[model samples]
Target: MSAERYEYVPHHLLRRRVRDIASGVEGELMAVINENVSDSPLREHWVELAHIRGASGREFTTAAANVVPA
Candidate 1:
């Protein structure tokens, strides 16, 4: 299915650098969630997501907490 490109989401390995970057950001945000305070680049990205999605990080966290992953 990966020969060209499917119309739906594709499952594939992430590049190491990209995974590392995401892991770093996830760690920062998770730290904030656990400790309720910490400086993190994710704070800025979270604000951006809130601005674009018209939703708050608290909403995201709540939703994520309820997810039933495939």
Candidate 2:
């Protein structure tokens, strides 16, 4: 697709905020895909990253479009 403008990635959970250790910039965040049942330290902090589009307040997945995954 055109680049998931906004998407929710499931995170396991974390003891403290990991904004410093993970990759990316100071204000930026990253997500890791976990195929196995194991968990990552990052997962413990972020339950889901609410990716926000521009200032339009219009998310990529609307109420109807969110019925199923693309």
Candidate of highest lDDT: 2
Residue 3 lDDT in model 1?
28
lDDT of 1 by residue, 1-70 (tens): 1222112222222111111232122211221121222245344222111101112333222222222211
| Candidate 2 pairs with clashing backbones | 13-43, 13-44, 13-45, 14-44, 14-45
TM-score of each: 0.14, 0.20
Local error of candidate 1 at residue 42 (angstroms): 27
Worst ten in a row by lDDT for model 2: 61-70
Model 1 residue 47 CA deviation in Å = 19
Q: Count the backbone clashes (under 3 Å) in each candidate.
A: 0, 5
Q: What is the lDDT of residue 30 in candidate 2?
A: 26
